[model samples]
Target chain A: MNPKFYRSHVLICTGTGCVSSGSNNIKSRLTAKLEESGLQDEVKVVETGCHGFCEKGPIVIVYPEGVFYCQVEADDINEIVEEHLLKGRVVERLLYTELGTEKKIPAYSEIDFYKKQHRIVLANCGRINPESIKEYIAVGGYEACGKALTEMTPEEVIAEVKKSGLRGRGGAGFPTGLKWEFTRQTPGDKKYVICNADEGDPGAFMDRSLLEGDPHRIIEGMIIAAYAIGADEGYIYVRAEYPLAIRRLEIALEQAREYGFLGENIFGSGFNFDLKIKKGAGAFVCGEETALMASIEGKRGMPRPKPPFPSVSGLWGKPTNINNVETFGNVPDIIRNGADAYRAIGTEKSTGTKVFALTGKINNTGLVEVPMGMTLREIIYDIGGGVSNGGKLKAVQIGGPSGGCIPADLLDLPIDYESLQEAGAMMGSGGMVVMDETTCMVDVARFFLQFTQSESCGKCTPCREGTKRMLEILDRICSGEGREGDLELLEELGDHIVSTSLCQLGGSAPNPVLSTLKYFREEYEAHIKDKRCPANVCAGMSAAYVIDPETCIGCTACTRVCPTGAISGERKQPHVINSQLCISCGACAEKCPVGAIAQG
Target chain B: MKSLEELRKLRAELEKELAARNSEGKPKIIIGMGTCGIAAGAREILQAVLQELEKRNLDVITTQTGCIGMCEQEPLLDVELPGKERITYGKVTPKDVERIIVEHVVNGNVVEDLAIARLEEGGI
Candidate 1:
């Protein structure tokens, strides 16, 4: 009997979010307190990865008891040690309460935010120590890699992936199995497998979190992918911005090598496979496969015209297969769990799960992985806890900056590749930015158009010039300088750009503008015809502010915050605005406690 | 690490260790300190718990974790004894620390009213 055997396990999140909020210091304090109290041997401390809800970082969870504690600091460690650890008492005042709930929900799965989520790619995230290979193996991690190498053949592996009906989770819904099969079939002496971790979507963190939380899973996935395609060497092209994810990957790779998973003949089967990391130098367009290959090649990181697809000739002119991080992450599970289990999860056409980064005005904004067939309403209202601050949902911006804004009417649309495409929105890497009623659709289009316009590689004239022209028209319309035929001209130019663009970046750039125009034409009409921004989001469209005499209390708060000093009044009397001097900044409106300051 | 047989043997060995670790025979306490937990003052609550325990000169194991996606009822904590059902207490403050220790940890009695969740015999 081991007396030193710990009875309690404490899991603290060492994910980037929690670490930023000083979780490391909190952890050290806990360790010190445990040592001081002579209770060090009974408790085991483990630092796991992100628990998805980053808003309440510096999080802590205790096992068996299943208690949840958030935002722990060094200052709070003493009381926690005294009351909870020493006395075996739970602190009553600091319990997490929502909607004034009387009871604490200790289990992580039963929480409202996770009630609807089906985590597949995110299975080990926040559950295991990302840096520990033993912890990874404890949760049936590398068994897939072992299973693939020992039990299955190269062709059999690809066949199983195909039978699973898994599609590429990267923007394009290309079949993963087919991509592997193409590279496998193509005649080549040496081949390569690449994991596209260049997740450039602005409002997305799914790939970054996946890499950070479970790096071994990805390594296993890539190893399986490499084995399937008969590829010996691999590269994971991760963005330079994701330093935490990168560091974890480096650690995981070294561990995998030590564990005899990477860089050798696996299980004495004579199949050789290994990998290297290529850091992307911050180009959004490099997310494209050709551009990514070009970057890896130490070239200018530009997309070339595809006649010989990457499968036939890629990365030093060898047969290659590229799949997104999430796509590859799903592969190991498919092989281990069997094709039928993966197939049964989602709809007939689209199988397996999709990890979405849910950001923007929605409540419970976090990383959510749902089966492919789940409706937008379920994602927004059920899992997301509806719009934040009691606001009405206006639209959901799917994909990246270039993805479409699906209106509230289309919330019933199933979140799959084909359905989203049919609805004029590409499921481009699962960046879902929710919008409230206050968001101006015209301005959103303009914002996306500006992003696309600036990121154009200038390889094609239509994408370069056409996106700029569309951006100019959108800017003019937002600035209340629109002509009658501006919208029509934008439509015409947008169509031309989509058809003629060389790469996917230039091609999909107009989707935001087109989708917004298709869904919210009335808002555009208001901007052009009535000279009014209905959502009141556009700055120049609505250019005046006035003090509502009935609502005003002559509060000096607004006067103090007002940059132009346009507001003036005596104490206890209604304030008057100097209209000539007012900059229409709406700072006073924000500063006013009452509904006194009105902007138009 | 090299062969399938070795892998299976290691699996069995690790499984035994896991079983030993999970076999419930002592009191345990878990806390939800995910980002949601932190925002709800879980840190202060955690610290307060430690202080209270030290004052009583008792022994316990306190740990924290990321959000279990319960943003609404965050800063949640759970208490379990050697054989007692796991009881979850919600909206806990430092003020409620002593009673939780006295009524629950020492007496093996669950602070039922403060509990949000429990492992009931019949069903959840």
Candidate 2:
């Protein structure tokens, strides 16, 4: 039988980032416009997953020609269809221009943001229609599950993963094959595999993107994991906040079941396995294995001490194996291409590519996957297109709230499990948030402390009370109410919290504060002793804006722009800002015509 | 649904459907969709090209182009093959699409009666 074909394939990204930026509207308009042109039969509009260049979202790629149009709006669809699709003339206006240059990148592969990325897990993300099972199959999606089930033994599969040096991408960097082996070694009839999709990091969306973009890859990975661990049932603990991810996963599960990939006798190998998605109530701590398993079992999501790890007792007291979304997303590729192929990409200890959610003060804010040994400078400067607004970079906060801040001097540090840990930051689910020079270090520490403090399950003392104490000190320092030796006191308390914390949360909760203190100690000292914020970020610690009488020119620009009646002077005289009425809002300073305003 | 062979068979069928996007080296059929081409019923020519390709199970990449500045030739179709010169057929109708695919594309023989011009190589 002949298959349907189109002259051109218009791949419009419908991932959450593009969807929020109105890619769906753009897609519908393109489809309607194609029909109007009477070329609907020849032209096909395909909705795929996240292209990862989320900074320039609503991305449209015309295949066969491979013309990449970014930041496309619904209104631009007509021009794209009429000019490019209909006429074959490339749309020059919609092309993505290179950063700091007028050169337009007509092809998607030529974009700097994608040029450095090694997308093993995300290979099918922006390429295929995620909702269609046929598309997934055509891309050799479930072939790994079949290979693992039919060709390789469960022990062989575990050994392959172990040989590949695959680690848990859920921040801990524990060996994934070891965890699977532990579960398989444990004596249990009913074993389970869980994919931890409950990603709650502030700037982390790598897991969510994997789930939304190519969910079947994750499903295929989980099936292989279940077969390895001798499990027939599994659950994916995804947070409720990810509505789009959840919806796509639901569709993938239904489709997989229909194709006999999820139900009994998958691939006719008699390896009966299935999956269920357990929606978390959006607790950050549930990302922990114990807390995740607890939440899945209909209990309050709180972390329990290790030793009786999930491998021995988890999810209604069964030996279970769990991995992160990206970890599972990488499994199928590893199985299909063998352990040696996977081991060849990354560093010795941390093999395969790691997906990072690149965000915050960066020019290209998107999801990027690079090999393990790539330097921070490469990911941030080369791929991220440097800091946004041309601002000088101050630091990069990795591993979310539980991670530490790496100062600008350490930008060349090679990113691997041991290297990041040695630098006081874990590979915490790959949330790399770039901080510019304008960001106050003390405030950043305070912000992370506030997040961990509020999200604390309150079951432990060090996390609940200790985080609060550290937060108070940070708040005092930011608000210009800090006392002498406050920095030393924070260090002492931070050490105590690290020692006394029950779970990983409390143990690593002081990472941001401690690391910032270790690196940017002078910033903390200036905030405390000088009663000033170097970045002018803290409201109470902002330096007073004083008008320089010599340069003020008496233009009354400062007076008119000031919200408060602070600036007062005659039409021809230099303006005098009443210090008492000044809110330190910098309006008068900005409005100074002769460049007279200065922060006193 | 049950066997590995069945899975492979299904995958093979689906891969053909997505071949236009994945295949690299193949014969291409470029239809002029410029304003002039559309007015000259190029839309019908495009539909006919797709139908002829599907009818013969031909693995050809069909794409559209904008105004080639040949308004008098209303509908223009360009066939490009690897290591071959690009043949431009002007004033093409829906009926000529099949013969062009069969005689020129399949048999490797240009229909001189309809062929108007030729470019050496890498002509869009």
Candidate 3:
């Protein structure tokens, strides 16, 4: 440490969110102002990756004090440097207000969003400079790889991981250690280890953030796995959509090779393990380990039958092991902190922290890493600050298209493999999207079905044809062409698809439809029986919004904003909406001065 | 960096240097100059803070960072005493800077009204 250097460090997030919002200007302005005041040497400025608080980007974090700032501008840098940096006085206006709190400006943990979170995979995300190998080394990034390769035998490494009780994070919840053991025992001349970075879930971004924020951690994990499974080569199958993650991974690979962590004679232990990055074609089905391996082998991405399950036959028909980016990211922590330490964090069944991307109608929409078995209610109301716009929460859709929609009543459902499975939801890459009362449950089901239907590779007879038939039923019901037995038909198709599917993609394809049917059958009944959308959100619903005669106070307020001029009335008189002219745009309802508009 | 033994030695040395930098003996302050705070008039509040501290001849380090995910309550500030729990203040004005310094910094008392977030559990 240089004696003339700054006594404090200010980290600004230049991640995609902050950069687009002008965090670069904030950095330069902060530096320029500090240099002018002769305090540049006393204060160091570093730009880091995404802090997961993208909603309040242009985030600034001052270390030692650890005061968090959000939505910063170039104009605010001068004040921050002058007031908070120089005078030993905090600038009250720049502090972040804890979500869901009445008055307290939460420190990082006090923020309910972060209180339940336990950082393991995201241990160094916003804390260190990913581009700097030395910064990573300072925080024990590659120490796990060293420990695994040098001291621990291959069997000892596997045993430690098995004891950690970490299940797969890629929705399946398979044991990571068991997978490695299967591959190790499989007879093969050249075994392979592949990191499944093809995160294709609709709202999922945890894998992308992990890969971008700490690429070395994943590389270290892969290296340690190679040493454990006695593999010589590894491949990282990442989705091409994530350019930033891909770039960082590439940079990290080059740096690791330079540092003698990769290539021949790693740590001088003579365990030569090399890695290659393969950009995926953005196929959702390729997220399945089999399909991902097939894609890596220069073939079409499609799911194949298991039992010979990657462990026995994978990636050019060799004994290969596959794990998601998040699963591998946890390996380093488990190695560094020991299995018992990791096992102590979560429930008996599910161990360690799970990173969740909290999005949709929640107030504090970002990424949160909470321990396993936290209730949905705490994650939503306490951490996510309930629904945005002061609307009541209708339901939370977790685990993407293959996962299930947990209703508002089951808000206390503990988030774990067994608990979530019983609730008809799976932890699919940790996408927890909180939906509000305005969100139509039927439409949500239809939207998920549509995503799955399009992403289906059509290799299996059940999912390929079953999803099409179910989607057609959903379309008819949504467009006001519903019959009495359409719901039953959907249930039957879901059961058949789950039973007869060839792969997990085919097997779990009916989750959205089945879950929505089981939990929200009332909404479907209303759509069919009353021909009305209770939320009035569906476009083709028969419900027409009308102004009540008793409530309409002769106000022509709705007449002006009506795009189609469907509302007609004179000044100081009750207005009527012509059903023919109304496009059901809800403009008159929105423009109504009184709470008179009703939809039924 | 080549072997495990060398790597462990480097880690110890680096950790020592890092620890020395964060001795907890020096007073520090931070401003939440993120997008939300900036939009909520934190720039001026920050200026007032600097002017107040400068007027009092108080020496401390100040810095800015992105949002802490609490955009609703922008214009945030956190004060760190050597060994004491960090006290965060919210919705501060140029006028509140003096009271925070006089009461909290000088007299070892926290202004409860302005004190918002406490940073004892998770500092960074």
TM-score of each: 0.84, 0.96, 0.84
DockQ of 3: 0.13
Native contact fraction of candidate 3? 0.24
Which lDDT value does model 1 have at A522? 93
The deviation in Å at residue A579 for candidate 2 is 3.2
Compose the digit string of candidate 2's lDDT tens values, residues B1-124.
6776788888888988777675468898888887788889987898888888888888888888777788798799999887899999999989999899999899999999999989998765
Q: Choose the strongest candidate by DockQ.
A: 2
Q: State the lDDT of candidate 1 residue by residue for B12-81, as single tens digits.
A: 5454323322434645556776667768887677767766665664556555545666678767887767
The fnat of each candidate, in order, is 0.18, 0.72, 0.24
Kindly list the per-residue Cα lDDT of model 3 for residues A485-522, writing each as its tens digit.
Answer: 99999999999999998888878889988998999999
Please give the distance, in angstroms, between residue A263's alpha carbon in candidate 1 and its true position after superposition. Answer: 2.1
* Candidate 3 error regions (>4 Å): A1-4, A99-106, A548-560, A568-575, A593-597, B16-124
Off-target runs (Cα >4 Å) in candidate 1 are A1-4, A92-95, A99-103, A547-562, A565-581, A587-600, B16-124
Residue A317 of model 1 has an lDDT of: 95
**Regions of candidate 2 where Cα sits further than 4 Å from its true position:** A553-565, A568-573, B39-41, B67-74, B90-93, B109-118
- Give the TM-score, chain B only, in order for the candidates: 0.71, 0.90, 0.74
Candidate 2 lDDT, tens digit per residue, A1-600?
677777789999999999999988888888899899776877788989998999998899997888999999989888888788777889899999999887999987899999999999999989999899999999887888888898899999999999999999998999999999999999989999999998988989988888898989999999999999999999999999999999999999999998889989887788899899899999888888898898998888898888799899988999999899999988998898999999999999999999999999999999999999999999999999999998999999999999999999999999999999999888998999999988999999999999999998999887899899999988888889999989888999899998987788888899999999999999999998889898988985877788787787898888888888888899988778887787788877776667899877
Worst 10 residues of 1 chain A by lDDT: A1-10
CA displacement after TM-score superposition, residue A74 of candidate 2 (Å): 1.3
Return the top candidate by lDDT: 2
